[model samples]
Target: MLKVAIVGYGGIAKGPHTSAWKKIENAKVVAACDIRPERLDLAKSAFSSNIGLYEDYKEMIDKEKPDIVDICTPNYLHSPIAVYALEKGAHVICEKPDAISVEDALKMQAAKEASGKVLMTIRNNRYSAGSQYLKHLVTSGQAGEIYSGRCGWIRKRGIPGKGGWFTTKAQSGGGPLIDLGVHMIDLAIYLMGNPKAVSVTGNTYSKFADNTEKADSSHATFGQAKEDGIYDVEDLAMGFVKFDNGSCLQIEFSWASNIKRETRFVQLRGTKKGLEFRDGIIDVFDGGRNTKRARIKHNVDARKLDTGIAKVLNGHEANIRHFVDVITKGVEPVFTIEQGVDMIKILSGIYESAQTGKEVLL
Candidate 1:
């Protein structure tokens, strides 16, 4: 059995990790760590009756000596905690936005190389039935030669609670761009066969954050809004990316917007065929007057497919199971550290472009 340690006892830890871990065989949560004592105690009380708990994750890593370390911490701590875990001879599964900066991401990559341990980022979108089928079509030339694509997560009003690490750039890196846009960007690039990014042009806005009344409306789950705390992150971000192969991508993300629908959509246009996944439906359009809609059935329970939270946990379990299978069978995991680093590089370029108001040549 592969022993595991879960670091971070937040909503994700309780909702996704705990739920998904129960489904995996030969894997057990031996310990859990969090900075918050109450959160740690809560995790211990709810998830595992006999699991060890600690305020310092490093302590947990040293004592548990787990085969895998699942990091569900805030964005900024991803690299440090992951590197530390890897250095201590544990495979690492870090939640997405792998690191805040490209340098940190590279450092994590280096650590993985040196440690020779599996390092996987939790990008659950890649595991969706819709995504998997779309990727197969794209790779099989059903999408033909792609020229352009657009992907976005548009929220009418969905800011997370204020005053948390999420709102602080020092803690969460950036705002909606790093938080939500990263997923679509990763999915888009992956479906595009990990294209070489050549340049990026982008913009950011925080107009909605200034209005306190709009904060509650923007947040989908509002635990508590600290009216006195600082909100310095972007509420919205948009970027245009050009690849070395002449393909282009237009991306947008928002915590608050005036859009009519709350859409999480990706549209890909190819020379011979076009594809779109909008509002959970996947459609294919061919140039020869052919159109087909791909029906997606939830292999798992409907309750298991709600938020990214559920998806991430389920995805993490699958990812870790695959990692273990690869390790035991002498193969490589589907998602590698190099791919994770590439994602970080692309996101960093987008943020740089938005800041400079110029096309960042990568």
Candidate 2:
């Protein structure tokens, strides 16, 4: 069994990461570290009281000598924690929105290269039943050559941690763009053969920043909101990415908007047929006659879908299994560091576009 040490025993760690490890056969949560003792206590109680817990992550890593280190900290801490874990000679598995900036993401990638250890991010949607089903059709020529796509995650009223690190542009980077956008756009681009994004035109808005006063904060990842926290990030963001393959992707996402309702989906246009996967349902539209009419759908638990930009299986179960398999079974992780680099590039470009008021060239 591979020994694992998890950092940040908060909502994500306790909820999905730990739960997924429980279902895996070759991994064990031997140690966990967090800034708060109460959070560590929660992890101990949730996983096993016998498992070691510490307040300092480096101390835990030094003493436990885990084979794998999982980083579940805030947006700013991801790259730093991941680099330290990699330097400690452990395979690193970090959460989404890789890092605060492309520069840090590049540093993490460099550290992983020097460590000669496996570095994986949680894009578990790639292995989901619905995603896997569609990937089969696209790659097997059933869906044909995928050209362009439009995708988004819209919310009527949703702003995470109204005044915490999530709202601070310095800590959480940007609002829904960095948090929710990463989860949705990455999946769509991955299905498009991971094309090189050449440029991006983007915009961001913060119409609901005043909601911090209401303190009705309910974010899918961070949980309840902090009434008196900083609210400097945008509530909504939209962008169009141009790929080197001549393909384009238009994306829009919001934490709080005056939209009809909250929904997440990706509509891909291919030469042979079209695919739209929304709310765990994959719809294939093949023009007129002589088109394959097979529709692949699954009735997944709806409760989990409401949590951020998740997939049929989310990144929890499938990602944990893939991380373990990469170590034990010598299987390659579908989303590699190169892909992570690509994701960071596009995201950073989006932010630059928003800031400079000009289309950013990647």
Candidate 3:
């Protein structure tokens, strides 16, 4: 049996990660760690009553000696914790953005190499039903030669953890660009055949730091919001990326912006047909002039694509299952540490470009 211990018993680790572990055979959550005593209680409620809980991650890892260390902590702690876990002979599966900076990401990659242990980050978006269909379209020569794409997750007013780690640059990296950007950006690039991002140019804004508006988005309740916390990170970020394969991606992410309701989408322009995944559904557009017709467009789902419906619809749960499979059953990994490093490099480059007001080459 593979023993798994999770760091940061937050909403994600408690809800999706633990729940998925319950459903997976031969893998058990042996322990959980968090700084907050309340969170440890919550973890106990979520997991077994006999499950070990710790306030210090190092102490937990040292004592438990878990085979797997799942990290769902704040952005800044990802690298340090992952490195320590890997060195202590534990496979690591971390939540998104990989690491806050390129340097930290590289450290994780190096540790994984030296330890000879698996390291996978949560690219949960890739496991979504729509995302799976899109992947089929791209790989099956339907969405041929994906050339350009546009992806974004924008919110009119949905800043999470107003004055907490989510708002602090040092703790959570930079606002939506790192928090939410990793989701859509990684999905887009994965669908686009994981093209190498060569250069990036971007801009960031912090307009709604003190707005104190009631959030209409369900996502606003993710992190605990403080009364008067630091809101130093950007609320909005726009960027463009040029891939090595000549394909480019345009991205925009905002925790708060003066726009319509919350929407998350990914659109790709391909030679044969274009693909768009907005909200949850996917649609394919065929601009080929057949007869005197203008264009052809149709909705596509897992049923139509014949891809087996996932037992776990939640992408987070499915991703966790995949992580378990890769470790216990020797299944090939879909997410790699190298990709995590590249993802951090792209995000960090965009932030640097946002500051320097110039394109940053990767």
Candidate 4:
């Protein structure tokens, strides 16, 4: 069995990652490390008292020498921890955005290349039922030439961790563009045939920094909230990305906006048909019949898919399973270190564009 170690024992590590580890037959979490004593204790309880717990990730990695390292830490720590784990000769699976900056992402890529081990960041959205079906259509040429797309994850009132790291620029990068944009943006790019983004133009806003309204999104409870901590990041970000293939994507991400409701969606325009993925449902619209001038629509509901599992698995679990398969079964990885670097470049360009009020070349 592959011995696994987790770097952060927080909500994401404790919840989805933990559930995924349990479902994977060839791997087991033998250790967990966290800076918080309370969180370490919680990890111990969940993994059983026999599991190793440490305050420092380096010490945990050195002592345990685990085969796999799962990183679910804050955005800033992702690159460092992943590099350290990769250098230690362990395959790594990390949470999203890859890293906060291009330099840090390159560092992780170098480590992975040096170690010659798997380094897969979580792109959980691609594992969703709707996404898989859409990918099938795209690869099979049924979706035709996907040239343009729009994607976003907008929340009515869901600034996570309020004045904590989620709102802090230094720790969490540049807010919703990094936090929520990664999800839909990556999905859109993936479905659009993994196009290399060439340029980006963006704008950011931080109007909800001091607002005391209660969060309406369950996502708000992700991290520890502070009464009066730093809130230096943007609450909303809108951007446009142009790819080398001549395709383009329009994106919007907001943690707390005055929208009608919370929604996560991606719409891709293809030559044959247009795909609309909203709130886990996919709708394909064939523009019109040549003779009748009537439109045809096909709706695919992800919730109704027969996944052949004991229970419905979220994208995280499916992604984790894929990671294990890649390591143990020599399965080709859907996510790569180079792709991660490209993703970071796009995000960093958007942030730069937001600041300079000009298009940033990636």
TM-score of each: 0.91, 0.92, 0.94, 0.94
Residues 180-296, candidate 1, lDDT per residue (tens digit)? Answer: 877888888877877888888888988876766554343456323567676889988988989988899999999888788678988999877898988668888986676788666
RMSD of 2: 4.3
Question: lDDT by residue for model 3 over 127-191, one digit each (tens)?
Answer: 87678778887988987889999999999888887898899899998899999999999999998
State the TM-score for model 3. Answer: 0.94
Give one digit per residue, the lDDT tens place, for model 4 in 57-102: 9999999999999999999999999999999999999999799999
Residue runs of model 4 more than 4 Å from their true location after superposition: 289-312
Worst lDDT run of 10 residues, candidate 1, spans: 302-311
Candidate 2 worst ten-residue window by lDDT: 302-311
Native-referenced Cα lDDT, model 3: 0.87
**TM-score attained by model 2:** 0.92
List the RMSD of every prediction in angstroms: 3.9, 4.3, 3.3, 3.7
**Candidate 4 collision pairs:** none
In model 2, which runs have C-alpha deviations exceeding 4 angstroms? 212-224, 289-314
lDDT of 2 by residue, 158-230 (tens): 7765677778888887889888888889889988888989999899988887753332325543743566678
Q: Model 3, residue 344: what's the lDDT?
A: 87
Candidate 1 lDDT score at position 322: 62
- What lDDT is reached at residue 168 by model 1? 82
